[model samples]
Target: MDEDLMRALREDRGVKATALAKALGLSRVGIYEAVKRGEIQATRIGRRIVIPAHVARRLLGIEMEAA
Candidate 1:
């Protein structure tokens, strides 16, 4: 994967299920099912479930940003 793409993926803040599913070649339904099963951590705010950027990176085994 390109470094630029990785950076963009890491910084992404929108609903992650779609992007993550596409990147991992998995279905969006699978992603949501995983979240519902606690395979990944996500929080519900109002009507949207938001997966934090760092949490997404961690789940994908991507490196964290330097402190």
Candidate 2:
């Protein structure tokens, strides 16, 4: 992975499932459904399910501006 992208990933605290869903015009349940289907990578941080920034970026083919 790119070093700058990794750094940005760490800084951004990953993408929340709700945010990711909103970005894709998906329902939050749709995001969870994908996770259940092993289509997306995510982890639980307490009560929140977060998609790793790198995985999210790659899945969406998105690029984030460097800090």
- Top model number, lDDT: 2
Model 2, clash count?
0
**lDDT tens digits, residues 1-67, model 1?**
4454466555665445666666667897888888899987887788666666766677667785664
Instruction: Report the poorest 10 consecutive residues by lDDT, candidate 2.
Output: 1-10
Q: Please, what is the TM-score per model? A: 0.64, 0.71
Residues 11-58, candidate 2: write the lDDT tens digits.
Answer: 765878877776667899999999989899899889898898888777
Segments in model 1 whose C-alpha atoms lie over 4 Å from true places: 1-15
Model 2 misplacement above 4 A: 1-12, 65-67
Residue 1 local lDDT, model 2: 46
Deviation (Å) of 20 in candidate 1:
1.3
| Quality of model 2 by C-alpha lDDT | 0.77
